[model samples]
Target chain A: MGRKQVWEQGEVLASAMRLFRRRGYLGASLRDLEEATGMHPGSLYRAFSSKEGLFSAALDDYNERVVEGRVRAHLRDAEDPVAGIRSFFTSAFDTGGGPEPDPGCLLTNTAVESFSVPHVAPGVRRGLETIESGFADALTRAQAQRLLPEELDVEKSAAQLLALYQGLLVLVRSGTDAAKLHTITDGALALIRARNATAKQADEEEQR
Target chain B: MGRKQVWEQGEVLASAMRLFRRRGYLGASLRDLEEATGMHPGSLYRAFSSKEGLFSAALDDYNERVVEGRVRAHLRDAEDPVAGIRSFFTSAFDTGGGPEPDPGCLLTNTAVESFSVPHVAPGVRRGLETIESGFADALTRAQAQRLLPEELDVEKSAAQLLALYQGLLVLVRSGTDAAKLHTITDGALALIRARNATAKQADEEEQR
Candidate 1:
């Protein structure tokens, strides 16, 4: 593709991703996609083959840009990996103060919407596994830093964090208050903190 | 309505509930509802006014029958409320060894699907709130029984459990393995267990 065509294609995929995240798979009609992407039906089908193909592309874009970006920012690059995980959870909610309700994570929305579009199941699973693995990596680092107890099952806790992440997204999409979600996030992180040897040492030092 | 008519209506709602749970809001078309309920479109409209109306009623049925039933079975009536909460989480998965994939909880499904069907938002919130409150009630009882530390925040922990519950359902629908889900559930309950004075005391007694 030419340079302009490549840029346009990226823009179209981004638009499609927003629509899918907001309306879900079945909820976003072909006509809706056309409108959102500013592309004609003939051009859309010619480009992406079918609505499912377009959706899969959009989901791929989401996993690469959104999911991976968050993982890198909060888990891999952050100084404190556990703190990064907490930031990762809190980051799902929009802090922009926009009037639009939170549309939730595209991976989570697709996972729930996969009941209708089973073809997207593998993509949804891939995105979720990415987050799960990110958590595992972060927890392992946290354990090495004495931020977590040595006995903590990093794999299982990572899986739990994945579930908790998805669950918070569900609440966000369901119009849960941000304050409430914050409290839940804090409580969840505290569960991890309670298992932190460093945190226990700090407590002991303070008592002394 | 006559007794027979009432019985038939209950049956139809159950069928509709299952269809919605399986297919989500927009995924379950009018024809699908007709086939599921064995009611013609005109009759369905006459009975429930519109698809949205029918969906509202079905959600109400779910909250009453499925949500409330689970709460009573695993939370209210169980001898140990903490164990009851654990059972409530596990109960979301199908243990029957059926070939059919888990349909997940209707409440979580509807919450995710509510982006398209905003009318069902209240019912979804109500169902989630019921579970959160159920968790709170159980935690309070556990604390009263000295099963939990007096300093544990019941409300915040309940909300965290609510998020965890919804997240697990998302994973379940997304086709995560049951064994993985069980481990996540156990880890979550252990967080609560870590806050259990009774459990700690029992550990101490055993060690002694």
Candidate 2:
């Protein structure tokens, strides 16, 4: 790829990500890509090879640019690993509140869309794995610091957190008025906080 | 629609539901629909109006036949309401273990797919509402029967359960053998079980 070609590829991938996120992998057509990227069908095919190829690139872009970046920030920035887990959620799913056009998570959307499009499913699954491991790593760090209860299952908690995160995205897609997600997030946080309390109680017991 | 046409419509909707669940709304094309339902494009269009029309009907069929039926069974059959909630998860997601094709939930798939297809989003949202409210109602009943913690936030717990349910579906779709989903379910059940223990303690305190 030449400099201009590489730059154009980046632009096309970025645009395709937005399009796929808004309109699912199968929903968006080649014409739609042409319109979004200002490239004719012939050029788009030559560049990305196929619609599946373009969608795969877009999903990779999503993983690298959006999901991985967030994971890096949340995992690296926070001194407290558990707090980093909490922040990962509040930021990924902040939604900014109220009824809005919440598309939920792009990777999650692809995960669901993957069932239909086998060619692109692997990329979507990899994206989910990246997130699951990222969360599990932070949780392991929390365990190392004894921030979580000794008996607390880090892997399980990580999965619980993953479910809560994706589930909330599913709920938010509806644009409901009730504070449904608020309670869900608080409940999850409470579970983590409860572990913290248990750890503290254990520490006090040991001190005595 | 004639009696024969109505029967055919039911069969087509049933087949379409499976296709949509597997292929998603946009991923499966008209030809795919015909292949699934054994109907020609002209017949399919005449019967269902359009591809979107067939998809909408399939979603409704899924809502009525699959989701609502499970909600009814779990809510009505189990006397212990919390256990009913537990059984609901186990039955709805019993993939029968090992490497199998677990499509997760059709409603959840549509919920993810709903971000793009405007016509089908409402039905998907309604299906979620049905589950959330069903869980909430069961919790409410559990509280009235003193089966759960009196102070337990039924709505919040319901929302948390919602997140857990959808999130597990997302995880299972990836075919990861991390035992991630197991912990999520156990952790969620523990939260409810903790409430039960709390209720028992409260009862003891009252007697004392």
Candidate 3:
């Protein structure tokens, strides 16, 4: 493809991503897609094949740009991995006091909206697993640095955090109060820290 | 209305609930509703007013029957409130080894699928709050009975549990392994228990 064609495709996917994120998979009609993407039906079909194809491509774009981007910023690169995970959760509900309520994570919305949609299921699973594994890696590092307890089950805690992450998104989408969500997030992190302290104390008692 | 009319309304709502649970608010078309409820479009609109009206009614019916029924069975009536809450989470993924995957909680799905939907938002909020308050009530009882630590923050813990519950349903809907979900649930419950134990031990140490 020429440079202009590549730029146009990129623009189209970005527009499609916004529409899908806002409206969800089933909610975004073809006409809505056309309006969002500024493409005629014939051109859309010629370019992306079908609505499902377009949606699938959009999901991929979301995973790469949004999902992986957060992982890189908050988990992989942040100085404090555990705090990074908390920051990741914070970002979900930090709508910047915008008039529009948070649209929520695209991967999470897709997971809830298109669980049985075959074309989109793989991308949904992949995106979700990315976050789960990111948590696991971060918790593992935290434990290694003695930030978390040695007895902490990194894998299980990671999975639990993943659930908490998804749950917060669901609540945010439902227009839950940000303050309440922040309390819940704090409670979860405190549980982890409290558990670590308890474990460390227990180890000290055993040594005595 | 006649007795037959009342019975038919119940039946139609039941069918509509199942379809909405399966397809979500936006995914369920009028044709799907017709096929699910065995009603023509004219009859459906006449009875429920509009597609949104039918969905709203279906959500109300779900809240009354499924949400409240579970609270009655697992939280209100169960002998052990914390265990009851556990059972409630268990029921979300318990498909009895059926060929079909679990459809997930209707309120959680709606919260994800139709957050901005004006007509359906209230029902979604009511249904979700019902579960959150159920957890709160159950936790309060558990703390009163000394099954939990006195220092436990009932409200925060309840909100966290609510998030975990919704998160588990989202994962289940996305076809996460049942065993993994069970592990996550177990981890969450164990954290509560462990925290309680730690708090109790600290109190004992203080007395010494």
TM-scores for candidates 1 onward, in order? 0.90, 0.82, 0.89
lDDT per residue (tens digit) for residues A51-141 in model 1:
9999999999999998988998999888988778778877788567888766668888888778678898999999999998898899889
Interface RMSD (one decimal) of model 3: 6.7
Candidate 2 TM-score for chain A = 0.81
What are the runs in model 1 whose C-alpha is more than 4 Å off? A1-7, A194-208, B1-7, B194-208
lDDT of 3 at B147: 80
C-alpha-based local distance difference test score of model 2: 0.70
lDDT by residue for model 2 over A24-55, one digit each (tens)? 77778888888888888877788778888888
- Highest TM-score scorer: 1
Q: Candidate 3: where is the Cα deviation over 4 Å?
A: A1-7, A98-100, A194-208, B1-7, B194-208
Alpha-carbon interface RMSD for all candidates, in angstroms: 8.6, 7.5, 6.7
Cα error, residue B169 of model 1, in Å, equals: 0.3
User: Which has the higher TM-score value, candidate number 1 or candidate number 3?
Assistant: 1
What pairs collide in candidate 3?
none
Q: Lowest-scoring 10 consecutive residues by lDDT in candidate 2 chain A?
A: A199-208
